[model samples]
Target: MPTGVAIRDVREQLFDAAERVLLRDGRNALTSRAVTTEAGCAKGVLHRHFADFDAFLTDFVLDRIGRIDARTGALRGSAGTGTVADNLTAALTALFESAAVAIVGLITARDELRARLRRDLPAGVPVLTEAAELVAAYLVEERDLGRITADADVDTLAAMLIGTAHLLFADRFGTPPEAEGVRRIVTTVLVGVGPRP
Candidate 1:
C-alpha cells in the first residue's frame, strides 16, 4: 500500500470502513488490519487516531450512538404532525437501516469494547439502548402534543419497539424487512396504548 497518500478526514474514513466491515463480515472478522485495508490506509493510521483496536471499536460504537443522537431533533420535530404510527414507522426504519443492528452485533461480540463503552454508557446495550431512548423522547413529544395517549407508558413502549425492531432486522442476510412489515410491527405495539388521537 502507498504510504504517502494523504487521506482527508481519516477518522470518518476509518469509521465508515469499520462499519462496512462490520456489516459485511460480522464483528469477528473485524480487525485493525481489515479496517485499515478496507480504508486504504496503513494499519498504523488507525493506531495513530485511536489508542488501540478496542479503542477504535469503542469510538466506532460511540460514533454510531452519536448518530442516533443526531436524529433525535428531526424526529422530535415531527411530534404532532403525522400519524403516530407513520412517524414511528419512519423513525424505527431509519434507525435499523443504518449499520445499527450490525454495530449491536459488533458490541455483543467484543467484550473489551463493551467494557470501554461502560465507562460512559453504564447500562443496557449501546446502540439499542440509545435507539430506545430516542424513540422514548419522540413518544414524549407526541404525548405532549396529544398524538399519543396521556396514559401511555412511552418509555416502556419505546423499549418494546426497539426490541421488536431489533428482532425483525436481526439476522437478515442482506435485504431489510419491508417498510410495510415494519409498520405492522409498530402499529401492533402501539395498539393497546389507545387509538392515535
Candidate 2:
C-alpha cells in the first residue's frame, strides 16, 4: 500500500494471489482489486508490471501452465517404475489440488483473458492442454516400454485421461476428489489399453 515499495517477485505474487481468489470466490470474483488485495500490494503494482488486468490474467494462467513442467518431468520419470494407473492418479491429484481447475474455469469464463492467451497458447485449454501433452508424453514412454499396448493412441489416451480427471475434480471449489475415487477412474480408463495380464 505504500508508494514506491519494492515487492520481490511481484508477478509471481500477483499470480498466486489471483489463484487464491479464484479458488475462494470462483471465476466471477477474480479482479485486479481482489488480486492486489490478496497480494498485500497496492493496486498500481499490478499495472506497473503488466499492461492490463487481462494481460495479468493471461500471464497468470500461462504461469500456472508453465508450472506443470515439474509434474511432467516427475510423471515421465515415473513411467516404468510404478503402475500406470497409480502414476496417473497421483498426477491428476496434484494437478487439480493446485489451481488448475479454477484456472480453467477462469479461462473459460473470461473472453478477454482467453483471447489474450490464445496468441501464445493457441490450442486446447491452457492448463489442461499442457497437462494432456505431458500425459501423452508419459504414455508414449510407457507404450515404448511395453507398459502400454503397442496399438494404443497415446494422444487420444492422454486427452481422455486429462478430460476425465478434469471432470472428476471440477466444480468442487477447492476440495479434490478422494484419492481412491481418482484412482478408480484412472484404473478404469487404463484398462484394455495396458499390457495383457
Candidate 3:
C-alpha cells in the first residue's frame, strides 16, 4: 500500500496477514479482501504477486510447510546430544503448531489450492513428504551416532510420527497433545528402535 514498499516486503506482509486471518477466522474467511484488510494494503496486492486466490493460498500453505521442514531439518544438528525421545518430540511438536495446523485445514478445504499445489510440487508428494524424509534422515543420523538401534526402520518410524502428528492436528476439537505427551508417544514408538541401555 505504501508508495515505496519493496515487492518482497509486500509479499511477506500479505502472507503474514493471510496467516492471521486464517488462524483467527478459519479457512472460509481467507480471501484477498480479508488478507489485504489485515495487512493494511490494497486488495490488488495479492493478485499482483500471485495469479489468483488459489495461487496465493498455495504459496501460503507451501510456505508453512517449508517452515516445518526447516525446523525438522535442523534436528539433525541435535541428533545425538539429547535423548532421542526429546529430540523427536521437539520435531513433532514443531509440526503440530497451531498455525501449521490451521494452514493444513485451509489447503484441504480448498480444492483449487490443493490441485494447484499438486501440480506445482514435485512427485505430487508436496512438502509434507519432504518433511517426513527430513525426519527419516535425522533418524538415520542418530542411528549412525549409535543413539538409536541400527535395526530401526527409519522410514517407517518417520511415517508413524508424521501420521500421528497429522491426526493430532486434524482433530482440532480435541485437547491438543502437549510436549510431554509427544515425548511419551516418541518413547513408546521408539521402544524397540532405541539403543539398549
Candidate 4:
C-alpha cells in the first residue's frame, strides 16, 4: 500500500538526511540506520533507493564534483587578463576555494570507499598528468598572446603547478596557507621565466 507520493517524499527526505550526515559526521558515520534516523524513516527506505552504501557514496562524490564544477564555471567570464602566472594562480585559488567542502569530503572518505573511487573514477576524471597537459596548452596560448614571458617552458611550469596543487590538496602533509601557497606556486614557476626586471 505504498503510495507513489509517499515513496518519492521518503526518497527525497532520506537523501537530504544522508547529505547532512555526510557533512556533519564524515564517511565513518554514514550508515543506513543513521540515514533512516536522520530522515525519520524506516531503515529499509535507504536500501530501496540505493543498492548499498558504496553506491550511495559514489553518487555523493559525483554530485559534489558536479556542484564544484558549476561554481568554478561561474568565475569564467570575469577572469581578468593578466600574466600567465597571475591568471593561473587566480584560477587555481578560485577552484580550491570553491571546492573546499568537497575536498574535505574526499579527504575523509573511508578506505573501502577510497579504493572504490580509485577503481571507479570516471574516464574523464582529471588526473594530475592530464591537468598539467591542459595547463601547458593554456600557457602556450598565453605566450602566443604575449601574456606570458617568452622564455617560459609551458610544459614544465604546468607540471610544477599540478604537482604543487596535488601535494597541497591530495596527499597528507597538513594544509598549507591557501594564499601563501598559491603565491609560492606562482613565484616558483615564474622565477626564471617571468619577464626580466
RMSD per prediction, one decimal?
Answer: 1.7, 1.5, 2.4, 5.1
lDDT of each structure? Answer: 0.86, 0.86, 0.79, 0.61
Q: What would the per-residue lDDT of candidate 2 be over residues 1-197, giving only the tens digit for each residue?
A: 78867899988899899988888888889989999999999998999998999989888888888786675558988989879998988988888777888888888898988888889985988888889899999999999999989998889888988999899888664456899998998888787898966
In terms of lDDT, the poorest run of 10 residues in model 3 is 122-131
Model 3 lDDT tens row, 145-187: 8988888899999888877777766665567887887887788
> Per-residue lDDT of 1-197 in model 1, one digit per residue for the tens?
57888889999999999988888888878999999999989989999899999999898889888886676447777887878888888888888888888888888888888899999994999988887888898898887777778889998999999999999999747578999999999999998775453
| Range of the 10 consecutive residues with the lowest summed lDDT in candidate 1 | 68-77
* Candidate 1 vs. true structure, TM-score: 0.93
Shift of residue 190 alpha carbon in model 1, Å: 0.9
- Write out the backbone clash pairs for model 4: none
Model 2 stretches astray by more than 4 angstroms: none
What candidate 4 gets wrong by more than 4 Å, as runs, is 1-23, 34-43, 74-80, 98-137, 149-156, 166-180, 195-197
> In candidate 4, how many clashes are counted?
0
Best by TM-score: 2
TM-score of every model versus the real structure: 0.93, 0.94, 0.88, 0.60
Residues 1-197 of candidate 4: C-alpha lDDT, one tens digit per residue: 24343655765576678767765676568787888888777777677778887676666555555555554443333233555556676656655554444445553456655666666564323333345555677777766666567777888887788667655664333454476678777778777665454
